[model samples]
Target: MTLLTALLNGAVALSTAKIPAKRQSLIILILLIIASANSFLHLWFSEASEHSTNIFVTIIASGIVLSNRAHWTASILFNWVGWITISVWLELALIQHFFFAMAMSTLLSWFAHLARKKLVTKQIELEIERDLAIQHELEAKAATETKSAFLANMSHEIRTPMNGVIGMIELVSQTELNTDQKNYLATAKRSADSLLIIINDILDFSKIEVGELTIEFVEFDLEQFFEELIHDQHFHARKKGLTLALSKGDFHHRHVVGDPYRITQIMNNLLSNAIKFTESGGITVHYDLVTLGDNLQLKVEIKDTGIGVSETALPFLFDSFSQADTSTTRKFGGTGLGLSITKQLCELMNGDISVKSQLNQGSTFSFSVRLKPPRQTHKMASKPPVPVSFEGLQVLLVEDNEINQEVMLAILKGLDVNVFIANDGLEALATLSHSQRLKFDLILMDCQMPNLDGYEATRRIRAGEAGEIFSHIPIAALTANVMDSERVKCIEAGMNEYLTKPVKIEALKSVLVKYHKQAPAQH
Candidate 1:
């Protein structure tokens, strides 16, 4: 009887172990058979009637299973089996052991519940982190969009007034004046030019930040270009009492395919920096052509006898919005973006810029660019003189700002062209519709205006909504939107050309000359 009772207790202990469900069920059945035999033995044998030992063993086994398994399902099965054995043995006095087993099971279940709760909390935390990351991304995107819109609006608003001021200054400078009046005009022009530079730098930096700057390759005469560039720099050098020199090596080829506008901008920036820093010594620009196995490289170097960069500052010389130090910026007066922009442009051209400098002696900036040689040699054409008169040319100048309108009026008056003004796109269309006797030769359309924008107006004109007579009229977009995307938009809307403000007289006249040739031959 004792052996059978021990077997029953051992089976109950193994019940909560990590055995398969079927194996566990077989063990439980054996335990029940042992219990039934023990009950029969107790009924058949007087010694087996003493059930105290069996009750004690069953209670201890139940407690062991509940503590080790720590799972509510296993604990319930153990408690049910223990109670059934006790009842079948008719041991109602051992019911006290059931209460003790239930208490131990409750304690173990509480701990298991806590572990599950901790897991859930950890999962919630991860979910919150993921949500926060998405929110932050959305906020950053919104902020970037807002910044772009603000910059676009500011570009147009500020350049409109600047055009009037700069245009008036250029006109005043052309008039005959005494030495003192000429100096005054020169100073005013310089200040205005400086402001324009700041504006340009900000716009360029923004474009670079947004990855919107692009490069263009076309045929250009490098020799002629350098000659003109040096000529312009000469005036600035003379003002500082410095000599500007250019040295050219043997040229096996003359015309090459590259972005001449970007090249000129980079050279201009380097020259301007040299001039700004140098006190007395001269600036020399040297370039040579090198032939590689299958490619030609143009190596250009600019050496300036100026206050050179210190060793520590050299590393960060090309860093944006940073100068050699606070003192250099305070004395030199610049936004410290020129060299950074220059370096980036060189890299974009598949080249790189390096600098060699000594504290007080000089600095030399050199870069080499690989360019493809043109199949046919191209000679630089002599620039045609600015039109002295546009006697019979009729131009429609569409502008909303009063000051801008006045500026365009003065410029057109100098060209001796009949000028017609419109305040907005709506007015421009209305004017063209009513004017059957006098057809416009060209339209200088501003992109941003009230009632309707220049893009929409151009669309209407191209769609023949403004009458078939106006459909073929050459229209040029004039605005302060310097972005390349804006230029593409203008072209897509049927504008023949794009001009950015503040517009110069030379650029305006050049555009007229270009399209004037294509204009229908006047009767």
Candidate 2:
């Protein structure tokens, strides 16, 4: 009987589970037949163990039934039918053994039900966490986009007024003035320029944070570029009674491909810091070249005899908006973003920047950038002569703001040109349509004007509704929107050139000269 129960347990476990569901019934039927034959053999021998047989039969039935807990009907039916039928056939009708089998199967089923509940709870918790993570990520992205838009709008609003302030100061300074008045104008100009720099730093830091800043590689004259940069730095250094010098390294590659604008910006930051900190002594800039395989590396070291940094503060030197000490900002007067920007630029170029300094002695800032040598050396052209006169030139100035109109009129008046005013785009278009015979050389169109914006006006002009002559006339977009997308919109609207607000006299002159040279001769 013991052997028969063991065989029955093994057969049921294997036949019910290891077999596919479609064949499980047939396999279980065959195994049952075998169990019955074993029981008959045990009966024929009359030498089987009853206790062991009961234990084995109980374990097998409970295990098979508990394995399918979701179908408790099958579990209960199989437990009662299989064990009771076998017990009756054996002629062992003990009520305790039958009760024991039923009790064990119920216990296992209850335990399985609890296990299923726990698994379901765990899965639900994991799914909830996943959804929350996705929601948070979406919120963060939306907030970043909103911040970018706000910064862009604020930039336009602030820069427009600044343009007028600085431009007006420049115009006033051109006239005769006493030493005191000239000093006041100079101080105002300095303040306006400083504010502009702060705005630029904030914008740049935002760009870097959003990963919008990009690097462009183009061939440029390295030596000439450095010479001009150093000349400007030297002028600033001389004003403070400090000497600024540049020493060239041994390996000389005159022309190389890289982003000249970013390189100039980085150098300007380093040199500005060197000059700002040094009160008594001078600043030295050392440039060297290191050859790595076929590529050449440019290493720049800006050594300043200034109030150096403390050891504890050096670690945070390249961190954004961080300074060496609390008193540093008050004494030096900066947003403390220069070094952070410089370091980021270096890394963008696949290079690195480091500093070595002593609190009272001096500091040396070193950086290295990988560069590609151009196919041939190139020389920079001498600057074009400044355009002094544009007599008989007719320019239509379309602007809504009275102060901006006055500013543009003053600048145009200084150039000895005939200027016509239009308060809005509608007026400018009407002026063009009515005065078809009058040949206008250029149209300075202001974006975001009342009645009609510059973009719409330019589009109409391009469509040739005003006149054939109007369509060919160069329309330059003048506005406070200096964002890349704004420039793209201007171009798409058929504008020839883009000028940002609080337009400088020199930049205005350059634009006029460029178009005047290209402008058709008066009919």
Regions of candidate 1 where Cα sits further than 4 Å from its true position: 1-141, 291-295, 378-386, 520-523
Please provide, for model 2 over 95-152, each residue's C-alpha lDDT reduced to its tens digit, 9 standing for 90 to 100. Answer: 3544765566456646654564465457558878999989998998888778767766
lDDT of 1 by residue, 185-276 (tens): 98999899999988988887887776667888788777988999999899999999999999999977788888888888889999999999
lDDT for position 229 in model 1: 94
Give all TM-scores, in the order shown: 0.74, 0.73
Q: Score candidate 2 by lDDT.
A: 0.77
Pick the lDDT winner: 1
